[model samples]
Target: MNKELITDITKYQEFYPPNSLKAINNVLKWKNSEEELQGTIEALTFIVNQTLMKIIPEGRIVFCTMLERLDGRFVLLDEIQGVLNLNNNQMGKNIDELKNMG
Candidate 1:
């Protein structure tokens, strides 16, 4: 399972770049399979979901639709990037600010 998570993180690193993706990959690689990676994925997922809740500020219905479109493989880094991009668009509202407010 740990190896699997490392593999996923590695993919994320490739999908992203020299950023948190690398940091996450490094962290996952260093920790023991029995220790760190055990619940790291779930924890990250939870954190991402919480952030999504802050961004949408609505019920799970819309969230589920978005997740389904992403095929259950959405990563926190990608979601944050999406929110940041949206915030930087014409609306010009930072997601971090909204998250902080919540």
Candidate 2:
């Protein structure tokens, strides 16, 4: 049987050169046997889903760090962060004043 090749192209943006039309398009063509269609569908599905997904991640900032040394030299850093975290505006003003004093 002479098989007819059918195709489905999609509109999808990808990282490419500014003048590249291939950046926003993917070509999926069905050819030969039915077995090959599975691979084509999977490829097309992946490309379509990837293009639809949010490129930029949405997440909360995780603050988890230990700042204490065995000798206790940088122990004040955590304490200062705690105070500044509680009142940043007031602490920022106080820090400015302290800097001007020197």
Candidate 3:
């Protein structure tokens, strides 16, 4: 039995415990969720802001951000570059800088 006041408004208490970060099956109906997704977003933002900032300065980093659409296809969101000292456009090529240098 759902404890929700409205049919589409799902209260996440059924799925998540207090302060829980686990998504479980909640991701399937992610867009329909009212509040829990916001909490997860905040948690992700906190992680990116707090932890990634510390690690990025240690090396040249390239990463991709992707979004999964409702039709189950993933779309490229953006490419993240962290402190790459080169001024060359090398997209979509896997260049092993260490091997190339040696």
lDDT of 2 by residue, 1-102 (tens): 111111111224353323322323334332334445545556666785675332211100111112211255555667645543544455445444433543
Poorest lDDT segment (10 consecutive residues) of candidate 1: 1-10
* Residue-level lDDT tens digits of model 1 in 3-50: 121111222222221223446657667644534554666567677656
Instruction: Using TM-score, rank the candidates from best to worst.
Output: 3, 1, 2
By lDDT, the better pick of 2 and 3 is 3
Residue-level lDDT for 96 in candidate 2: 46
Ranking by lDDT: 1, 3, 2
User: By lDDT, who's the top model here?
Assistant: 1
- Tens-digit per-residue lDDT, 1-67, candidate 3: 1212112212221333235434653656445354765577677778766754443211322221111
Point out the higher-scoring one by TM-score: 1 or 2: 1
Q: For candidate 3, what is the lDDT?
A: 0.36
- Model 3, C-alpha of 92: deviation from truth (Å): 25
Provide the overall lDDT of each model, using Cα atoms, as 2-decimal numbers: 0.41, 0.35, 0.36
